[model samples]
Target chain A: MTTMRTETSTGAEEVRPKSALEPLISAENVSYHASGRQILQDISLTVARGETVTVVGPNGAGKTTLLRVLLGLISPTSGRVTSKPHLRIGYLPQKIHIDPVLPLSVNRIMTLTGSFTQEQIQAALEETGVSHLNGQSVFNLSGGEFQRMMLARALLRNPELLVLDEPVQGVDYLGEAELYELIANIRKKYSCSVLMISHDLHVVMSSTDRVICIDQHVCCQGKPQYVCNHTEFQRLFGRQFSESLSVYSHDHDHRHDISGNIQEKNQ
Target chain B: MTLLDDFLWRAIFAGLGIAIVAGPLGCFVVWRRMAYLGDTMSHSSLLGIAMGFLLQINLILAVFVVAALVAILLFLLQRQKQLAADAILGTLAHASLALGVLAISLMTWIRVDLMSFLFGDILSVEISDLYLIYGSGLIVLLVMLKIWKPLLAITANEELARAEGIPSVPLQLIFMLLIALIIALAMKIVGVLLVTALLIIPATAARRFSKTPEQMAVIAVLIGVASVFIGLFTSLEFDTPSGPSIVISIVLFFFLSFILPAPKTYVLR
Candidate 1:
């Protein structure tokens, strides 16, 4: 495989042609077993620098388990995951339930994991288009607003790799498209590699460089168009469904503010 | 007689010290929804007292050791997943208390003030108890300040904290130990039965006024201090039980908090 390159120990073997771009994260034959049930089996994938890879799978397909293993939140039962040394990863979890009893402001949530300057917090919030929510209580936030707040918090880390687990959950259709666009913008702005999980098969982000479709194990992996046409993907998600799948390319000239009101682009 | 020699003064000092440490830790308890775990630890503390008398060791040391062991046992049992979390807590909580009562009753040779251990006799606190409360309370507060950020991160979301490279497992273990330590220390002032009341009520009352976690913690401490002062003075005036009076005072503040307008930004669930 083009993605798999063995490390050369001796100086004599170093003459072999090396790929110009190295992978930021690579997993080899990774399998995870929990409670005597195999959740993942012999999964292999690589995320190279500045690449956006999306993992789409059905419900209970161990998509979350794969993300947790890659993030090292949980270890694989077999095989291994390798990442570049000192790699900074910003992870946005599926959902964070903040109990109402604990009064937390958006500002406090930004600094939950580490201390950040006020300017840094503002900049991150502005980038995510949630600057007005800085001092508001987290309990008062709408679903889409909360997701943006979480995304902004993740960006404060200045991560080399941004990992998201089901980023569009609990969002409306329009909000989902807006969030996907925001993510694509972030990837370009920060020049960070993106790894995300999505359960929706009908729509995949068009900016995604690679699509890995998995059900307990990898069914098919390639560019979005190739994966949709693969027989393995068609079998997992019926041929009729696969044929209807569309890449969500952002072609709109207007953008919505936090209030969902449309505004024309200056250009 | 000097203030240090006065029993009432010693009691007040000890109560204030406990309140100071309990406030911040209680915010964590309320946030993480571990009030039941607190109940489990304190209820098992009676067994710690029983073991102390039997082994002829320092009561506080015995209680700390026993509470820590129970916390660890509960941790291991949770991993087994044989029973639901509350079910396991309920079983351990009552079983330990029953064993403590049985063991204490079986020992006919010693004269134990069972009511005092159950209900607490804070008015009779000695100066040495003040030293222990202040010294341990200081350590608890310092350790809490050190782990404040990461602990909040874990409380907000454990998986996210782990992904951010915070060592959540070890931090949780340390948090459990801290809870055990506080329960052991406060048992002398609030007794085993009402210990959790002091840990949770002030925090609950402080929740309405806070806009941030740190603000909640500080306000909780202030409210705890107010409760201790009000409870001690009222008990002195009315000749009531000191421990229960303090808890009653805390409850009064909790109810009074509801009457006042909540912070403007707070969103009711």
Candidate 2:
């Protein structure tokens, strides 16, 4: 099994360039409640520009709720969220059930936000690798094709923040890896910050800059490798994934190839 | 031979006006699966009629007010979380129907034709009724046109719509009010019992034949207008009930839709 090796730690007291350090969105102790039951506790997070953050948690872990709150779909019960003004957000839901009665083509769905020139629409679809499906009915597209089409739609607005909620819900394992690679490429090309919720922690960690482990609260957060070694995360997900777990400790935790081994350095 | 002088001509014009508005509105009803919501508003028109008599006000206006109030009530009740939406609609529909009947029964001074209100008296449509139908129906259509894009977005996926900055709450309230207005305008033509039949059947038939929301809405209007003409002519020849005759024609069209091949190319606009 491939393992994520920790490399750099950004949170450490070290000199960092000011222009590259500002966060695109920051939540200061946000909490959400529905009726009397608490759905989200005092949680905080920050996403910087041109970085990819993956939220990992069990079912009903308030991941979706956090995304909705960040998107301003629902108000937090208390605390505050500060975002860069005029933040253009591109959101892709887990799965959109477009009514077959509506007769929506893939190209037509792009026009839902407003009018877009044909060339611009073509460019976005091309970027997402679904250029040929521009005229096809959205209902007729396969699961992978649909996700790409949705990504195409989200890319049309030239969003600064791209938010995806469970992008690989029904995708096959191979397709899931390819889609994450595609997303990473999109982030690099657009220089946009990405916030995504995913259950496939194993594959996504390679592309992710930061991983937040949450269950009704922000249980642990840091670089992907650091969060993977968190006690709370192990307690929550360790039962089903005992063998494949790879623990790597480093001074400055950052990106690393999964195939790299940590045992040689320790020896 | 003058259009205003003949009651049959007046009935035809009134039914046509209702169809123009009801068809597009009904497409939304079918798309959102709110046929029962439409039914609830239509059924409550009876209580509106009873209120009209008690207040000595215009019947259509009273019906409009009552249906609008019921729409608001449904909105409020929906927030309670105590009862499911279908249950609330069912309870409201039956309760209002019973109360209207009771109110009519208690008032001995007014000689109300209960069957006409229930089944509608298309033959009895006055020239004044035609004015109300066209004027109000025009407003409903215009409002629908203005809100078409956002309403379609909401119907397609409400969470996505909200995330995209559409004001879903106001749009929903406006949609409910539009349904209420259509019910009030259509009550005299199709009656309280079959108003939803008028909205639903034509829209459903059009769905099988249309390639776009706009196409479906336009075709729904065509189907609705055709049903009205067919039902009216059939009533004149067969002497059957006019409202039920229109509903039967629409039902026939809906069934005929199955035989026609579904449209292949979905036009974007």
Candidate 3:
């Protein structure tokens, strides 16, 4: 069972309160049971306008399930999710298998919603650095290229909220940083709230406004720095993992793994 | 040339009209990997034929009604978590075929050539059959053209289409009804056994050369028309069965596509 309510704006005080504005999206203690297994526990999070939130967790931790619940693609077994009325959400799924028999060009996929003009489609592709691939078959795109194409398609709606399951899943390490940076720029450019799932700790540390470390439920969520230093995060990811991320965060030039010290790839 | 002068011209017109509708609808069947679903619908159409014979109703109307009923049943069954789609389809396909064959056997009032229902008698197509083909074919084509974008969106990615506020359930139901309607119309051109081939093969052949979905649909229609012409000519010259002959023509075109540079591809199912 789920319920959603929209309240009228209360009287304003002399000083404007940030809380007065409704959140762009929020889930309230949502729990989901699927296939007779509990995929998600009581989980709650909120995304305000213009905030970039990243969810990080070990695999099989119901991150995708949580995203689907938040997206209203599936209903939770208990609790509810609320959002601003008539909110437009753009979703970039983890992986979409476009049938090879169906011939779809990059430009064609962007206008799938039928709301974009040719110029708008071209501009969105250009914005994502995939303008050259406008006429290329969607099936012919490489993983990184397809990810960018999906981003371009998602941006066509001019969504107030963008939800990406894994924005840079198959991208190379360098491409990963560049894509995250591109996402940050897109957030600033569109001024839309960005929600994504990621495994790149170093990239997420610098890119997101808030990092929610979830394993079945919210382990901890706050500033990336705070979450990185939290005991729960350390236990889940390990002390060594957070230390390496911290080192990478500070140096910004060298790469390091959880078990090893900094190693300069260029030098 | 008089309108009913030769049966060959009537056969050509009937076959071509069926192709006009089957081509685009077949492309969706191929794109969505619903070939088995097509087979299931066509197979169950035989049950509709049997019931029509028993009740002395219009054969075309009976086939349409039964096919639509099976589609609705499949839709409801798919909602239930117990059975996989293929399992349900397999049961329905064979059960409907057995029941249809049994029902046909039980009727002794009129001698029915079972082979004619299994493999079509395109050579004996009446002028009235042409009217049914063209009239219903036009409606299917227009409705398909209207729903093409949303249908393609749902076929490509149901979640994405739903996210974009596309009415997926209604679109899917409409798509199923279109397939049922086509299957009913196509029974005379290609019997229940060969109807799926008419829908899938030309579409597969068109995929080799197409660069866009609209291009694919158009090319598929051309391939379908060409197959009908070739198959009918082959039937005349070689004394082969017309329904199977058309499917063979389509298969030959699929093989002919080997000359094109092979694209790196994967089958959905």
Which has the greatest DockQ? Answer: 1
Candidate 2 chain B has its poorest 10 consecutive residues by lDDT at B260-269
**Model 3 regions more than 4 Å off:** A1-21, A246-267, B260-269
Write down the worst ten-residue block by lDDT for model 1 chain A.
A1-10
Model 3 C-alpha lDDT per residue in residues B153-212, reported as the tens digit of each score = 998898888878888889889989999988888888778799999999888998878777
lDDT of 2 by residue, A1-267 (tens): 221112234555534563545577877788989988899999899988888899989899899999988887777888677776667788998778887877677887887856789999999999989899988877778888889988888898888889999998778888888898899899989989899999987865677889998998998998877777665666667623622444563332322232222222212
Give residue B239's lDDT in candidate 3 (0 to 100). 88
lDDT of 1 at B40: 92
Per-residue error for B228 in candidate 2, Å, reads 0.3
Candidate with better DockQ, 1 vs 3: 1
Give the Å error, residue B53, model 1: 0.9
Evaluating just chain A, the predictions reach TM-scores of 0.84, 0.84, 0.85
- Candidate DockQ values, in order, are 0.60, 0.32, 0.39
Interface RMSD of each: 1.2, 4.2, 3.8
Q: List the lowest-lDDT window of 10 residues for candidate 1 chain B.
A: B119-128
Error of 2 at B181 (Å): 0.7
